[model samples]
Target: MTTTSKLIHGYEVVIGFETHTQLATQSKIFSRAPTAFGAEPNTQACAVDLALPGTLPVMNREAVACAIKLGLALGSHIAPVSIFARKNYFYPDLPKGYQISQFEIPVVQGGEVEFFLGDEKKTVRLVRAHLEEDAGKSLHEDFIGQSGIDLNRAGTPLLEIVTEPDMRSSEEAVAYAKELHKIVTWIGICDGNMQEGSFRCDANVSVRKPGQPLGTRREIKNLNSFKFMQQAIDYEIRWQIEQIEDGHAIQQATVLFDPDTGETRAMRTKEDAADYRYFPDPDLPPLHISERWVQEERALMAELPRAMAARFVADYSLPEYDATTLTQSKAMAAYFEAVAKACSQPKLASNWIMGEVSRRLNMAEIGMEQVPVSAAQLAALIARIADGTISNNAAKQVFDALWNGESADVDAVIESKGLKQMNDTGALEKIVDEVIAANADNVAQFRAGKDKAFNALVGQIMKASKGKANPQQVNELLRARLAG
Candidate 1:
């Protein structure tokens, strides 16, 4: 929830989220089918997945463990006993007439997702996160006026995380989605690959006038990219506002966003719980988990992102923002730690990594994993800057050489490019004296209590040193001369 005002056309936009995170299991939840991506259509699905006769559904223990892991990470209560139900539906992709999912009693009960909306902390309450098997995809392309069914994803295990209507604006919704993405990927339960359909989000968007009852909502399905997520939500908000303003009622339906058109179109009427006719599956017994098993899984859980970020703030004295950004991924956190430890300058390391390093990575359209420079190289560069061996500007040149594969050794790059800072005390003093004599007017202004004039004199000295002078040393010596 956000206290900040986010009203569009005198209407407050209400949003909820439903995210499907594909578990990193080797096999399907109730079958022996392989869960790998990019397999040939219908090749990976087995008899049990296809609902063939003489096949009985058997639950996978690993999937249950994954559910337990998510419950612990979100601070949710893991149900000691849960049931699987057959949700009756019909589609070309579903081999069976019904899909298996959790309806009445979900595994993970109630939790909250906390994230920062700019500088404000916001939390979205979770309704439930339940284990379900995904329906196969209906492929429209590569066909002549006919659709194709791909059952490879039919039986994949998924954790459906539902959120309350806590987001007030599209920005908050996007922020919440990204934070959830980082958590799932950090905990090793999901790959967070949007392109590969590993993680997907459905946004339930509605708009209502302040103090009015909740508006009818439309769900935008399969928003695979964060950029598109924001755009889709924003568009839907505007559309709903316009419809209400025109004296028309908003209809509840399922919609799809056309990225090319940048608008949402109605697909079909949305279905309620009664329409699905859910009933407990007869073949499978009640899914039960003992307290001992929950403890065992909790003991083996990895450190969550929020906890790690808090640790960085406490141990290294970093700002909360820096810690969060550095821990976006495990590899990124490891790289930052190595650089900070090697140079013994946590703030400097944070600045460089977040600024220049991130700029280069974004411009190249790659992640930290594909970054060309090694941690050791960056550490040595920062160490030189700390020791006054090179000016900050000179260090950039050295970094460029290292990043461009011109040289591997930091010292070699410094020497070859003549980037070493001028450390000769006597020579610097003489340069200070010459600049003072030539700038009598500026000197008079400085004596008259003008700080800008003093800065001008320091700039002259740095220019005379060919941008190689240590700025702090120059400032100190100039201050001493003026006082004398």
Candidate 2:
């Protein structure tokens, strides 16, 4: 190992991510607490979730089924026996004082998730995915003086997915997170809501040489956003490099992401496995998953989003870029397919989606799950343009109204707002004559064989039509009239 590598946390900027994906089950992992989003604080909590005395925990069957489905999808070995353990920790948010997690034998292990960085496809190895119970949330706001602890989120079912140190850069980290996000949501296992903490990442980062002892690593926790995850890793890497260059020894620690400053600060020295005092829980028995359950889950599998993207490229005749963008999320892929099924041109549907539809969705700070424009609305707009009832420019205006709250009816908005193009033969012919008369010098230049002079007349026709004349038809009419 090179001295430099043995020396940022030494070797390379080795990265491993631990992502927590909340299961889509209606109840908590081992309790009956309602798993609804945006519930009133403490209302969803049950006696079991509150960890009261004399309460015995019971595991949810649906949670197990969901985990098995995910395990099969990742091509992992479903262990015949898995045990739950208590990870002792102290925090205001943790109502149970100890988190119920897996220690020695987890549900699934030795799996792989595949992704394409560019032209080259690659796979990131998975260490294990275990079932864990989430802690409650501490609300710093809405209380007069003291922070409130909301147990509503407590006992929530979480699948903690740990990865091997295979990623080398922040870009790879982001891409890996994105690909995993797609997979969890696509498989109907997790909701994949980063904002709601349904999906979160803890980045394990260290620096080392080509061949050297690994440097002391820090765990950066709760990287809830994609941008923040990338930025935190990059900043931590640079900080480690600078520390080594300054002849400082790297210390193992736990850190948190400061999204406001786009940096990572050390929270505490990282804990070793022995520090947690993990042990199997006597209350809960070992979970034995059989071949029958695995087979049942395999039958319930849906086509993966990545495979769907490839099919769109081959069958729908879409650009790889378009297919990739539209198929990143299940809702978007379904919406795009509906538009294409409506017989609107495939390329045209792609253009509108990647253009105005995405633009408006981003502006509104919403994802495809809450997309305002429906497939039928988009398909109808495309059809209107195809039939020459509205020009491309007018369609954009109608789409704007459709995206915003201005208008709900695409066709009515076109007629009521006078946004339709001047496609009438007689009306357009009158405008063409006026444009020729107004630009006499240009008309003379065109008659004398200067082909470019006709552009001036086309611009005039568009201006006379209030910028609503079909530019293609205007150009064709201008060429014929000028040549004659």
Candidate 3:
């Protein structure tokens, strides 16, 4: 928990998270049913998934491997032995009367997620991450007064990561969520596709007076987007505070956020451990993982984002912020590396990628994988800037041409657009001389120690040269002429 809590309405907001990350395995948790999305309902649920009579559960090895990978990534302890329990629950979409999940001895235990909330590092400690099988979807859009059950998602492999109530605000919670999302997607365990329900967050939110005991929390379910996650938490915090201020006792319940209404409504009373009636599953034995298996999985893992960012800082001499921004995704980091290596200019490459490339990507609402400009093209453009073939402004023109598919060759774009800088010293000297002669008053101000006057003269020289004059050369020539 954050000690320096910024109270809202004289109450400290407390938040914890339960994230359901669907593992990227080819099959379900206990069956061989295909785990691909977009299949027709009831077609993918096998006998084992449907809990048919005499069909015993068989654990998927790949799912356990994925769990181990997550444990390693989060610095969690991977238990050599863990138990699967039957959680008794009644839902229309749950074909099995109970969900197979971990109750007491979860596979992963005692880790923490670290993230930057606007330059202040925040850490959210993990209570546990357990393996579980997902329930099916209850579809209600197409039917009137009747709902459809899609068992295709039943028995899907999932890792439910539970966090301590550490976050004190919506922004901190969102940052933590984003960092966790990046880690999971970076390691290839989960796709981190919240839109398709592959990644989901349930936030438990409450508010209490400073130094008071923790308030009763209401769990907001299945937040699919980061935007909605922050919004829901903010609203819930305000609601809880309002209830307390109005002398109403806050109830502990599960709630759902209505994005359309921007308010959360109670779904049902939250269930405790006893309410679920959890018991060890008799059909499946205890899960046993060997130390050798953990080592093998760790060896197969790629360098994580944090380590990659640190390397960028050390190897490329980049600022911490630049390194962090560049490594937002694997594709982005790979793109930066390719451009930097080709041009042998890491700082210049970092500037362009974090500045122009990021701007275009945001405007197009696309990821780095969908960027139109290739690494070679960007490298060529950066090389031109570094070699004084063009100015920064001219390089932007070349970048625009490449991004919009107007031209593929950077040199061709520069030649056609007449973006090459005026490198002739004699010609630049002549332009600078003429500008000084034309602007006598500005010259006198510069001699009088006014710096803006010198800038005005430089601007006039560039204008007289049609913006092709090399700025460095212009500055040097102007200083020499004024001195003489």
Clashing residue pairs in candidate 3, if any? none
List the candidates' TM-scores in order.
Answer: 0.96, 0.77, 0.95
| Model 2: per-residue Cα lDDT over 1-484, one tens digit each | 0011122354477888999999999999888778999989999988888888888789999988988988887878889899999999889988778999999999998788876665445578899999989999888865577688899988999999999888877877888899899899889898888999999999999887766776788899999999888999989999988888899988999999898898889888888889899999889999999898889888878877767889999888997778877877888899999988885577889888888888888888998879887888889889888888898888888888887868788889999889887778788888888898789899999889887787877878998999878788888887778777
Off by over 4 Å in 2: 1-13, 31-57, 73-75, 85-99, 112-123, 135-155, 193-196, 208-215, 260-262, 274-284, 301-303, 367-372, 404-412, 416-461, 464-469, 473-484
What is the TM-score ranking, best to worst? 1, 3, 2
> Best candidate per lDDT, number?
3
Q: Per-residue lDDT for 173-212 in model 3, tens only?
A: 8998999999899999999999999999999998988889
As for candidate 1, its clashing pairs are: none
Model 1 over residues 34-65: C-alpha lDDT tens digits?
A: 99999888999999888889988899899899
Model 3 TM-score relative to the real fold: 0.95
Each model's number of backbone clashes?
0, 15, 0
When 1 and 3 are scored with TM-score, the better candidate is 1
Top TM-score hit:
1
